[model samples]
Each structure stands twice: as C-alpha cells, then as structure tokens.
Target: MMHNATYMGSVSSVSSSSIIIELAESMGSGIVIIEGKNYRIGQVGSFIKIPIGYNQLYGVTSESNESSTHDVEIIESRSRRWIRVELIGEMIGGEFDRGISEYPSIGDDAHIVVDRDLKQIFGQPTAGQFTIGKLSSSDGIDVSLDLDRLVTRHSAILGSTGSGKSTSTASIIRSIVTNNDDVRLPSARILLIDIHGEYESALGDIAKVFSVLPDSKNPLYIPYWCISPENLIDFLCGNISEAYKTLYLDKAIEEKKKAIKTNNIKDFPTESVTTSTPLPYRIKNIWHELYYDDTVTWKEKEHINAAYAKDGEGDAENLIPPKFLPPATSSNPPFKGGNNLVKRQLEQMKSRLLDSQYSFLLKPGPWTPDKDGKIEKDLDQLLADWLGHDQPITILDLSGMPSSRLSLLLGSILDILFESSIWGKNLKTGMRNRPLLVVLEEAHRYLSKKEDGLAKQMVQRIAKEGRKFGIGAMVVSQRPSEIDETILSQCGTIIALRINNATDRGIVKSAMSEGLAGIIDSLPVLRTGEAIIVGESAKLPTRCRISLLPPNKYPNSRDPAVTASWTQDRTPENYEALVSAWRNQEITKEEK
Candidate 1:
C-alpha cells in the first residue's frame, strides 16, 4: 500500500452514473496520493467523474481547474470547474478487471485511486526509449517517440498553421538524435520533404539538407531522365486530353521492342524483329508530336509516318526520317507535310523542355534499353543511396522539386519502397530482411479523399499491407477530416495535439474507442505540446506531461510575433538591402 492511499475520498454526490467526489486537502495537479497509494485526480485534459452504486461508478475528467485551490474562481463551463477522471480499470481481488463499472453512489466509501496500476498499464517503452507523455483523458495512449521508434517506424509530422504540429514533430526527432547512447542512432534513416522550406536550421547540422536551389549546403539533383516515363507524361500534360491519351497509348504499343531470344543475327533478322516487349523511349516528345504536331500523322488503315515542314531550311527529308517500316517497302513513302504546325509544336516542346522550371524534368540521366524497359541511372543511384546504404537515416530533401511535380515525386518514392519490400522474393530464405519505414509529411494535401490521388493509393496500400512486409507508415496531418478515412482508420496509433476544428475533432472521435471518443472532444482547448494519445501502445489512457525537449528540437514553424518584432527601434538591413539593390541598381545576375 502506498502512502497516498490513506487519504481516500468517498462519493459525495451521484447522478446518471456520474459520481462527484469531495477532494482531499492535499489533492493537486495530475495525480494525488491517498492512503499510501497513488491515484489520478486532475489531468492536463478536462473530464468529469460520475458516481454510481456498489463501490464502482463511471467518472471522466473534463479539464483541469485553473483557479488556485485557496482562491476558487467561479467558471461557467463544467469542464473548467471540475477535474474529469474516467473509470477505466479496477483491481478485483488478485485479478485485474479492466474498465470501470458498477458506479459508486452517493455516500459510498470508495477509495480515491488516481495512479491505479500505472506501471502495469504503461510499462516502460522498449529499452533505449523513454515515455515522454501519455494522452490525457483518452482510452488510447500515445508515447512520444525517441530514436528507437522514429528511425525504425519512419514518421510524418503534419498540422495546419499554428497547430504546434511541427514543433511536436521536431521535438521528437531532436530527442532521438541527441539522446542516443554512443550515437547509436547515427545511421537512423530520416527523409524530410520540406514543403515550405521551413526545417533548414532545425535539422541542418546533424542531417544533411538537400534542395534544388543553391542556397542549401547540400543540393539535390532531380535528373530529368531519371523520372519515370509515366511520371514525366503526368507532369508535362495536366489532365491530358482524351485524344492525346488514346494516341499516346497507341504509340506505346507500336514502339515496344520485342525480346531477342538469341544475340546471333542469324537467328533473328532486323526485318523480322517482333514488337512485344515495352521499350525505353521519351514520352514527352512522342506525346507532343502525336497530339500537337500536324506533320506526324496516322493514315486511315495505313501505317503512320513523320514529315518535316517546308520552312525547315529545306532539309525536310533529313528532319523527318522514315522509321519502323524498312526503306524497301513498296507502299511506304515519305509522309507529306501539311503546314508548319508540326515544327511549331516541336519547337514549343523543345522550349518548355529547355525552360528553367522544367530543367529537372528533362535531363535526368542516360536511359538504357533493357529487356524489361529503359532503366535510369539516376534512379538506380538514388535507390542505392537510400536503401542499399546501411546508414539508418536517409534525408531526401525535396524542397527544390517544383510544387506541381511534388505529388508524383513523393508517389514514386512510396512505390519504390513498397515494390522493393513486398514484391521482392527472399522471404523463405530470410536473406533480404530490410524493413523500411516511410514517413509521409503533409499527408492531407496528397492523400485527401476528395482527389483520390496517387499518394492516397500508395499510402493506402502501405497502411493496409506494408506492415506485413516490415514496412510502416506514419501519416501526420492537421486536417484529419480532409484525409481519406480508410488511411486514417488504418493507423494503429494516433498522436493528436490541439485541433480546434469541429470536423477534425469529430473525425478523430469516430476512429477511437467509445471511451476515447469522449476524451477527444476536449482537444480544442489543449495547451501547446499537450495532446490526447490513444492506441494499442499505451496501458490505460493516462494524462502525462511531455518532457521539454532540447532547444535544437524547436520547430521552424513558430513565427516571431509581429507586434514584438516591430517594437524594436532598429532592425537588420539584410532583406531591405537585397530588395533595394535589385530594384535601383543595375545589379549583375550573380549579385542580384
């Protein structure tokens, strides 16, 4: 028996399965010890305790009472006035009967127990890990991850503006990297896709930062040729036209190179080469020529051919050469040019391909023709750097990728990881036992139910089947309502911070157990860093104060207050000088 158990309080009031308990003089924040045993009285989250009969009753804490115990201020909201504690589990004889019931009625002498079997419920997290905090007033509990889970499970930190979601995420990452013994987490694989370029200083030192712009120390190169052909078409053509799509598919069939059974020329002749295997080719030019170019035409029930415009330096034959059909064919003649339409189209494509914005899309690497298809050297290198390397953390800095192409870029990463882990054949021998944890940040934008987008497909698959193949996905999103319900529901553990939106709150409530649903209703009023954690990972839902992380763990999203910043008489002149030089001076391109 613990010392706090001696101060047990009895039920003083009862109504509708709710019990009101008179607080002991020594009761305080979080847990109160009574009669030599520890018991929870109030939590960071709000709830109310209800009293029923038979020494057991249902009670829940609504919120923490802010008024000093000596000077009580009258507050209208019941959640603010009374500490809510839900009846979860009770010790019955030698066995533990989980979940509280048999409401203790008025005048029932029930021992006040707050820290009821906490050790058994939350047991310490795996070695090399520590419990930072537990969800307040919810049936499910979430533990702030250190290096052990973060590196192994891959995590995404997401939230809306001012949600403290970024702070929480950065804090967790910082904890892992800083606290490891012997720097055990040095190779922890971490890839941060900075959407707004906010996490530069937060992780710059320990982890190498890569971006498209030259501002960062380590720059990323998205070679144009490295992007998958399908991804290239999607990026170049937005919501492709029906005619263009049909023609593109038709072209895909015609250009396919068949497999060669024998390298010997005597066994397979050039003229007799069959078209069965898909071949490596550029879809950007092919799609552009077929849809926008007039010189490249398909005859009615006749073979198609490309032609050069008359204004092309009079080298029309050189510009458009006969392909596929041999020169010896009797019916095949050079296609006649209708106008300069094809030349204009080709020029447009060439211009776009050369543009600065599409530079990353056009020049990826050399594409080699393989029996399977065209293999990009850049993608192979990237994969080798990410997975083949034994290092635990791989930080893929995607800040430089064009905003329009971000979805496809992220989708490709997910596809690669999933295909490599699940489809690869080495399970029986247990040789290739590498389990990957893919963390998708800002998941709501790409995995929204409204779009049913590609990210949603890949994430959904990972959520459903990735776990079996040693793959786990952590989706961090502020707007839970906007995310696909299937993916959200599939998450075994949920770490929710302060969410004020009614719809978002409701979505969280729907996925949790009935006991936890009641707890999520109070999420809007939670303080910064205070969250309601619920899931399989916790014992009984507990209200725990998350320990403060080191300064390096601070997220970049926190903005300096405008009022305070303006109050200073003199400010730094870096931004002002840059703008002035660009506008007034004939600045050299490099200087600007």
Candidate 2:
C-alpha cells in the first residue's frame, strides 16, 4: 500500500456494517496535506477507507462530533473529533463489489478515499448501465445506474420546487434515450405523464407528444368509453342512490352487449359483458333511456278521460305529456311516486357533455359513438399511436385538462395501458416483449393517501404486480410526505434531490435503507441538480451532481423574472390575450 502522512483517524469501535473513528490527537486542524494535495478530515457523506490485508473496506461518514470524554480538570487537553461511518462495500483482489465480506477491527487506520479508489468502486460503465453524473466528492468519477434494475424494480425522483427536479428528470431521460448505444437498451419504451406540458420542448426531438389538442400532424384522442364504469360514474355523477346506480349499471351493460352484437365484434366476449367492460356503447342512449324511466308516470287503463286527452293533446303543441314532466295533479291517476332519483345525475351529465374542455374524451374524433352506437375507430388504433410508435418516448400532455378531474383522467390512462399489457402479454407485440416505463410527474397530486381514488389504486397495483407483466413506474413528486407510503416503499430506488421540508425528508428517510438514513440529513444542503441515489439501481448510495444540459434541452420550468417584467412597459394586448385564454379554458386557439 502507498504510504502517506495524511492519516486522520483510527477505528475505535467495530460492527458488521459500521465503524466509529476516533480522530488522531496529533491532527490539530481538520485539513491535511498529502503529496501536495489538500483533503478535508471528516465530511459527512464522504468516503473513507479501512485497509485490512489485501482487502479494503469502504464506508461513508454519516455522523461526526467533537468528543469530551476526558476529565474536564485537564484544562490543557484538547477535545478530539470522532466520525461514525456506515460500511458500504469492499474491494478485493483489485475488484470492487457492493457488500462487505470482512469487518474492520478496532484500531484500523481510516483514511480519506481519493479519485483512484472511487474509480475502482464505481467501475467502468458497461451494457445495462448509464452515467447520470459525476460524484460530488470527486468530479473525475462518474455515477452510473443499472438500467435493468432501475425499470424492473422501479424508481422515484423527488425534490422541492425550484431545486432543479425537472431538469434532473429530463437529463436522466435524455441519457437513457441518447446513451442506448453504450447501454445496449435501444428499444426502451417510456411514457411520460406531463402535467405542466414542460417536457415536449425539452425532449421534443426524440419524443412524440400527445395532448388534449394536438397539432394537425399529431392527432390526440382518449375515448370516453375506454374509461372503466366505476371511474366514469365518479366523474359524471358525484353521488346517486343505490337503486339509481343499479339501473345505470344494467342499462350500461345492456347497451354494451347490444353494440357488441350489432357491430359483430369477435374480439370482445358478448356473453361476459360487465359494467367495467371496455366495449364501446352510446352514452347518449343510456342517458335517453334513464330519462324516460325517471320522468314517466303510469295511468290505469280504465281512465278514459286521460286516454282521450292524450290522443287529442298529441296533435297540439301546448299540451304537456306525463313522460316529459311530473304530473301536476296527484289525485288524477294511480301512478308510481315521482322517480326523479337520477335528476342530479342527469343534470351533471348534461353539463359535462356541453363543456368543450372535455371534447377530447366526449367527442374524440373517429372514436365518438354515433346515434346508431357505431364508432369509426377502436382502442387498438389508439394504443398503436401511443406505445407502438417508432419513438422511444411518448409524452401525454394533460396541461389543458381541468384540475378537478385530473386524477380520474390519469387513472383511465393507466388502466387502459395496464389492462392492455395483461391481455396482450403472450402476443409478439405485447408489453412482455416491449416493457414500458411510465413516468408520472407531480405524482403527489393524484397519489396522495388522503383519497382512495382510481389513480392511487391503479398506481399501487402497478407498483405491486406490474413487474411481472413487464410494466414499471417512475413516480416524480415534490411532496413525498403527501404521497402514498405503500407506493413510496415499493420503489426499489429513490433519487432524492434537495428537499428542505422536514416531513418530506423524514418520509424519504423512512423508505430508504437504515444504513443510508444518515446521508438523508444532508438533503437540505444539497446543491441544485445534485441528488443522493439509493436502493437497487445504485451499487452503493452515492451523491452526484447531475450533468448540465444545453438551454434548449432544459425543461421549461424556469421561474419567470418578476423584477424584469415589472421594469418593462405594460401592454393591453397581453392582458387581453391572457383573459381570452382563461375564458376559453385553453392554452392556444387550436385547443379552443
């Protein structure tokens, strides 16, 4: 071993996975000069080496404190500093591997690890690995993640606002798509759920973006019938009586079966049609039938006055029918009590149908059902445009959607993709052959534990069972505390950026391995675009500064210059345009 005079400390306590280091009394200052190179003593999150025979054990300093164990009566005695380190891995026979085979004994010399030792531990980037950035301690050494484990086991990227979370996410994705040659993962399929419509401009060159309103070249559509019955009812009707729900389900099933038979859809099993079945049916027809049942009043056959009046009134426009409105006189005939139980639901449906904001779902081009309950397009065509595309990345932009229904819409999208993957797993073009990675941006919005909505449930299911079916999820969020704990715990890897909130940091800490819990305390002080990665994907817990990208390739999440804007002259045209966009519930004229 190369000898130097930069020794800082010696191991005072030994454990299977950690060791406590007592600083040398001769080291007066925390800084040391070795071979004309200056190195800091004990910095948390930094690496330390313990050499025993031909094997060298590596650890990261997690905690450090000044000690006063000696008697206070000795005024001339100086206080010593001690560091607590968590053993990460070991290097044996000049080969670095994760996990220690031998533990260091007390009195072992602990020295700071330099670039050469880091290079050996990190190893060279090979197939199935992509470099994210350089190590924070040593810029020369790069940090690479295992792509196979990253997708199959699942991962998460979390940080507070303005901490460069979006840029880090974009950089990671860009690396995956651009470094395919080095990683040997050319056919990577990634679906990004863009909540703010920011990634399109950043990754537009390599990604195919689909939005509520797309340009002429790219058609965007999400068929309403594609939504499961439970989600559909939740969106259209806030609340309804049990009897009304049963009636709705029966009508929906009847309509779906009829449409299947009429269209001769061999792919769908007509006899097994259920409320949750994906067969296309006319929503308008269901509404019309329900309206007829809710408002109509029955009359006795012996009531000749009512029968003659009905015939005479049919020819006159002024006469009102009992089917169209509630009866004015209750004593006129023995009739069923007013069955206006679905009045609120019908009203809600009418409002949703008329809202142009929902045109993408309700009036999807070619996917819309006609009066005869026939559609020009099918789910297969939609899936081809989304997953079976030439591009490796597909961005589903949901910025124009209403916030109130965003969770439901997201749930529908996940359901469609997951359900398709399950049924088509054995096929040549199924997800088993082409595994998918779904990146959910702002995941906390829909995955909070407070509500048991469809989005949360579907995401949870994907986290649990998706790996077996060739599906993976990358949950990106700023508020980790608010996200579902079950989903967070399921992630095998977590890329944590600078999180300042104590609650958020605590949540991340709990999800991470106990050995790495001490490193999480440095989260609040991490630089922008720098993160500490832990779990299956990373060989060892590492702090890395994400490589920078060009301005054009950066995500469009830069904060607006308030001071600069205020210095400029105000314009009426700008305000007018903003008002127009707001009133139209759209970002551009194409959406309107």
Candidate 3:
C-alpha cells in the first residue's frame, strides 16, 4: 500500500519551491487506474504528492519535456521524460493547508494524487465555502471558494466575448443566494451594475430590476443633487468662472440649509456641510437664477427699472429664459448690467437641461426638489427602494443611458453607496452589518486607465478602503488589459475564462500568481465556461468548469443566430418599429 499504482516518478532536482521529477522508465503506460477511474500521467495542473514522515508535501505538474523525439502520443511520450512541478501546499495530521512545512529532498518519490488525496486537499463542504463548480478532472468533486476572502478582498471575472462570461457571472451569484438544502440566506445583498441592461431576465426571479426606462412601478431616479456639487457643476455648466462657480455653490448651500430647516431634519450635522454634500436643491431654479444674473439688463444705473420683454418673467419650471432687452448702444437706460457675460457656458447648461435623454438626472421623480428645495420624498426612500427589497440582489439597468454620461452616472451611484457605508458603519443598516457586493459589468468602459472619469476615481477609493467598510466589487470585463492596473491588482481573486487575445491573456497572466505560468498557458485552449481561479480566495489554484445557468436564466447578451435566422421564412419588411426604437433609444415589445 505504501507505493500503490498511483506512484509515477522521483524528484531528480530541487530549487526553492520548484522541483524536477524524473519519470520512472518502468511505467510507460501514461495511464493509471484507481478504483476503476483512469488518471492521465504528466498532465499540467495535475497534483503530485511527496511523503516525509507523517507530513505529505504536494506539488502541481507545471511543465513536461521529453529527452528524445518519439512518434507516440504526447501524453505517452512525456511519461518517459522529466516533468517540472511547482510546490503548492502540504498535508499534516490529516489536515490540508497551503505552503509547505518542509521541502522534499532530491531522490524523494512522487506519486500521482488520486481521489482520496483530492478530498483531503479540498475537504468536505462547509459553511464558509461557496461552490462555484466542480473539478474538471474529477466530476464528483466540487471546487468551493472561501466566501469571506472572495468578497472582502474583492474579485474579478475576465474573458473574451462569447466565452460564457456573462452566464458564468449570473451562475456564480445565483449559487450564493440560491435556497437549497434547507439553507436560506435572505439577507445576502448583491448590487449588480448592469451596464447594458442584460441581467433583468437572467436573475429576475432572485433579483429586483431597476431601469432608467422603467417598465414597472420601480422607476430608476438619480437626482442630480444626490451627487457632489463640484462634479455636477461641471456637467451642468460647461466652464464657469471661479467667482461664478462659488456663487452657484453658495446658492446651492443656501437652498440646502433652507430645506433642512423647512423639513425639520433633526440632529443633522450642519457644520460638516459643504458643496459636496448630497442634499436636495432644485436644478431648474438654480439654472434660472444663474441665467438671469448673467444676462439681466437694468434700465437705470441704480437698477430700479428692469428691462423685460412683453412675455413677463419667464417660467423657471419650463426652463424659459427670462426675455431681456438688448444693451443700449448709447450707453444709457438699458446698459450691459455690471454682471459678467456667461452666455456661452449658460447656453451649454441650458441645452443639457432641455435634453430629454437626461431626465433621470435633471428631473428625478419623487426625489426631485421643488422651487423651494422641498422634495416629495427624501433620500431614505430611494435607498430603501434600491437596497431594502425582498430579493437578495438589485440590478440597476442602465441600457437606456447615453454613453457620454455612463461614467458620471455609474460613478455617482457608487459614491452614494460607498458614502452611505462610510457614514453608517456602526448602524445595522450599514454595509458593515449587512455587507454589499457590487458587480460591475463591462468594467473597462469606465475603469479604463486612459479615462479620468468619476467612475475611475470612486472605484479607486472603493478598491482601497471598501474591504474595511464591508463593500466588495466584482469587475467583469472582456478586455482586462484596458482596466487600470491599480484597480485590477486590488482584486485578490481572478476568475479567468477562455481568452483568445494574446494581450488580454497576458494581462490575466500577470494578475495571477507568477508561479502558475504553466496553468495560465493553457488559457487559450480552455473550453467555454471553463476558468482558472487563483489568489487569496482560493486555497489552491483551480481549473474547473463554471456551473452553467439554465437557458431561461441566461443573460440577454446572446448573439443572434445569423444562419438559423436567415434560413427562416422572411416576415413582412417593416423597419418602422426598428427606426422608432432606435430614435427613442428604447426596445418596444415589437422590436424586442
């Protein structure tokens, strides 16, 4: 029993954590069977066990080379040559752990790791474990990840398009909150940033969907005042003078103070109030005042008589600019009032205000402030509508959003949640008490290194301090190379699916442990849905197939079958609905 059929080779050389094993010439079969199960020899990522006393050190086969050319199969040919192994972990007193307690000397016998050995290494399922999928080599065994480390340390899921990346993402989260085996985790909070609005049907049964173009009762509203005034000012007013900027912010603060007093918000920390505070202030009213101040004309030097058109004072609610009289050519009566001409900047701001595409931000329902900065409902209800729902997940669908503002809106959403967590750290409703997992789909769009958007800034903050605050980010993208290195490195666990692009594969390679180059090398040929999981969350580097979601549960990102569709009977050519959908930036039932 000491040297059973599992024995394969002997260590010929040792250098630190790396070792070279010389295959035994007696075993040229290239296959070993244990309990009627076949195990291939000299396969990369396969485990090799070395024993010294009661402790057993394990190493994974990383590379294999033959001494002479042969015509036989690659697996058979490599069985007669030496193989390189990277030291992974050890088993002592029936317990499996990472890192070796003792190094195996040269000439130590190394045996193939079998089913029982894998069980010792992976261990039985436990409360701290979350099963993502099963081991590829061994179907009966599961590959469970360390849930606490996976979340607290942050994680990334990367792969090329059509590699089952989105499906894998949906499946992974589904595993967490799925109620099975008498287990119930109703408090599991996962906030998915569905950039393309693809997750509504994927996780609808288990997730609450909030869309900018709400098809249901839950209308997604992000009041402009909820974001920092400094950021919002830039988007609202193109480029205002520093003096005008100050005046605008002052007006905002005044309105906020008035709101605090009028609403009678008790025990408020007024001293900490700044232009950055998330407080309600009517945007239309602010824009109206600024426009009038910049362009108003006075009939006299004392400004006793105002120059107004026959239309009276313009409606601020409708963004009607108060018609003003032109400045007098003779420098009398209507003069260019002492105010500076901010026509260019204010004009830009007015165009933004008038665009219907930005209604979610400009005229947020319920949270929108009246002319007096009084709101129909406060921020508390907005938070509850997003986080305090019956489902374990909340999907914010931003498919209807314009790409130009994607970064700003996404970043503002993150800022809101992260700030909430920071302020309510000790409270039961805070992120610390009930941790939140924020899943960012198509992360490269906003997190790219070349862009300096608000999304990048807020993501950097969350990546650095979120662990301590019980907030986790899962960045999902096809192009990992485009993501900022700082942000990518912060992710302790990386689930790399099949990557065909060399640059993308290289980026994924660099993000993983340097010792697993052999495993990373196998990326290009991996089957769709297969992934290599490594880093702090994984006790051992694992290559396994991600559990597949049901067809109905798949994300709405599937490519249309061109061949199958073309072969079908042609329907009446009616592009009216298509044009209308494109013009409206929406998917009508007919178009869908």
Can you give the TM-score per candidate against the true fold? Answer: 0.67, 0.90, 0.94
TM-score, model 1 to reference: 0.67
Give the residue spans of candidate 2 off by over 4 A. 34-36, 66-78, 180-186, 214-219, 298-338, 570-574, 589-592
lDDT of 2 by residue, 145-164 (tens): 99888988999999999889
**Could you tell me the lDDT of residue 104 within candidate 3?**
89
lDDT assessment of candidate 1: 0.51
Runs in model 3 lying further than 4 Å from the true structure: 66-80, 179-183, 269-271, 338-340, 590-592
Clashes of each: 72, 0, 0
Minimal lDDT window, size 10, model 1: 317-326
Error of 2 at 51 (Å): 2.2
Question: What residue pairs are clashing in model 3?
Answer: none
